[model samples]
Target: MKRRSVLFSITFRSAVSSDGCKQSFIIRYTSAGRKKSEPSTPIHVTRKDSGELGDHLGNGHLGQSVHLPKRGSSNSNLGEDIDIPLNNPRTSSEPPRLKFTTTSRPLVTKILSSSDRHPSANCPNRVGAYTFGPGEDYLFSEDKVYIVKNDRIISSDSISKMFPSGPRHVNAAVYDQEREILVVIEEKSVYGYKRKGSDYKLESVYPKELPSSIAFTPNAAIRWHDKHQMLLSNGGMFALYDEYWNKSLMTGRSSSYFKNLPDRVRGISEWKNGKANIYTQSLVFIYDVARDNVAGEGVSVPDFLRC
Candidate 1:
């Protein structure tokens, strides 16, 4: 069966300037009909201030339109379409807009080397990485924090400088953009850092050990939810916690439609409308936060990520 196209929108903020002003842009795209021969997908990127649009051809070039292959096209590297709901509201009078932009090179080129392995590594993990805006990604590894810009590591700093006596092995980290704070999770504690001018200041710490219901692990994944709580998952179990380290709920696969699946959760990817994609070793499924249940059947992991 032919799957319907899905619209995706991404917004990016530029680094703060000396004067405290910042620039931002939006990228919108759709996985629609496909052509047979063309291998690249076209993306539209729009500047928020000027409303100017730029076309990004998947080949790392701008201002060109590229055709995308059909679904399940063996010749194409683009994976299957995921039906993500567009969160931005639009009126009937305005036409739909699509935009796109990406780093010039892949972001994992340097971090995936065999010699650079760390104890915190987990399959399909994104624990210590957070993207604050376009071309800005912060990676927490061991006692160091690296800043990546335009797919390249620009600078790094000792974790101690950001959070005095911080954990040497960060299990999970996330940046709350709305609150302008960085949250770090270690073995049994959570720390929060408020963004200062060009640095971070330790603001709060939860010294209490985490409950057994959602204990920290190398394989754990966390994302800040819009409802002001952290959504965390490990193996097949999921839990929610507030800033005070209070656990409000605990759930597992046995309570959802995916109960028959294995109890191995590789990672969690947040999406719009209080929904998230839970990735296992071989399959990916949707989880709805509002319903606290699996929303759909599982799909095979994309071929690109299998590598």
Candidate 2:
């Protein structure tokens, strides 16, 4: 059976500026059940002679005579279609579409190496616990807080500088881009560190209203901002805010396609009790892990549960 997909038709009209720079106006249309033109602002591009990357100057400007493709009428390979407006003030035609090619199998499977010595050679056992620094662009691991540059240990010369997780294990860690600080999360508390003259020292520790586990939340190294407190991906996206919660954020899900936050990464802690839970935007799944991979919808809300 053909899978269902909501297609978004985006159109960008390009023109060469007087200075030989490319300028474009973006127009978009979404077709699920009804076709509707999305209002967008005109966007300006950088001068070609500037030797810089292409970027929009300002917000998108609304365009005139928007055209939406007729259902099942697009010349492109995308199967879905929609009805266009009758009096759109312009001729109804399909907008320019980008062509996509599909291959039966992956072209390059080995990123670093295909030796199979590790999952992918040059990758550590605990990849989901990896963290990157701000500005310096250095990588660190959450297990022993090993700082690596080109896979070489560049952590502070002192052994004590490492933030090992065992007694008061680091539940989570993120780099604050704006402040150039490293924020660390523990079981019940949070800590922040900033680079001083030569070494990073304790900057602050927020002790009020720290996010707690909602059944499977502690499994999530990163927490969410919604009141639902929903997050259960092993490796997920994080937005480090001055205020702890109630901010815009994204996390991992079980879709096999491209995922915003990775939930299927390896090197995760093993599940206990032969039982596991899955969280989605709308539903939660409970699965028995010991025997067969049998999962049931609608997990029972426990009266008294531990994080």
Candidate 3:
């Protein structure tokens, strides 16, 4: 019995960069359940359209679509087509250096200031607002006093940057990754930015209370969970807000030594399988939102973790 089939579908995958060199390679497959690869080398095509190695296609080993360069091509310009390896076999025991290269388009960025000196136009001491961009791009924007900003976007392409504008400094800001919405807490109101194509639209604004001193650290206390829920704290009391930005989905107080000061939100998360956990003060509030009720009574936190 004999069967014929087209088994080749070639796709070029870029090599990762290290230091000043990139490792380009060609892949070979085998029936032994192993992948074989060799460094891609430039070839000066001969009249036969072959490389240093002979016509590597005699047995139809390479697919029919594989096209070799036509003759008269000089590989002297190989450096322009391939990245050279960084390590010199003769010396340099150090690790390979890194190089920056990306296959994607660039983002946008805005820099507000760069100084922390006395009475300068840049680098103010206070932070009024901060938020990340849509599409999970590594761009972040911040607002400050006098409406100054030093925005930045982390990206592989040097061009990936962002400049998201709105009201002045925000007390706190949270990004809803799933829905691509930005929720910002301000001195007197909460604002929501909905992602529409490359820009954000102010969809909702809930006027209520915002704490005067909600300094955003690496670990922000307020967060978005589920489809339309947010867990927030003043430094002591905790509450859940829905997407409307109009009313509290629910509110709860912390029974701890921190009751006198403003309540702070510690954490908020909901698993894909529907389990939810909200951490604040010394307790964890688990909720089953499908039922709109607490999953269980207040549970004690473990000592190993600091809420």
- Kindly list the per-residue Cα lDDT of model 2 for residues 1-307, writing each as its tens digit: 5444444534343233567655443333243445444443434465543322222421133344544456557556353322232222223234457999986787765343233222211322332232345423222233444444332333422223543221234444455545665555555355666766555676544433344322222233322212122223444433223424423243333343222322432111113375433322222244454434436444221110100
Ranking by TM-score: 1, 2, 3
In candidate 2, how many Å is residue 19 off?
99
Q: What is the per-residue lDDT of model 1 for residues 1-307, given as tens digits with 9 covering 90 to 100?
A: 6555533222122222344443222222334554223212323233332322222211132233434444545543233332222233232434667888985976564344543333332222232433232235555555676554433345667667756656665655655555665666676676777766776667755444566666544344445344444434454445555555445475444335233333455444545687666555456567776776677787654221221
Whole-model Cα lDDT per candidate? 0.48, 0.37, 0.39
Q: Measured by TM-score, how close is model 3 to the native structure? A: 0.31
What global local distance difference test value does model 1 have? 0.48
Flag the better candidate by TM-score, 2 or 3.
2
Q: Write the per-residue lDDT of candidate 3 for residues 1-307, one digit (tens) a residue.
A: 4432212223222222333232344544344434555655523212321121222312233233444233344534322333332222223335568999898978867332433222332322222222334434221124432211222111211111222445454455566666666666544455667767765567644334544332222123244333444444443454455445344545555444222222233444434355445444445466564655456665543221111
Candidates in descending lDDT order:
1, 3, 2
Better of 1 and 3 by lDDT: 1
* Reference-based TM-score of each model: 0.39, 0.32, 0.31
Best by TM-score: 1
Candidate number of the best lDDT? 1
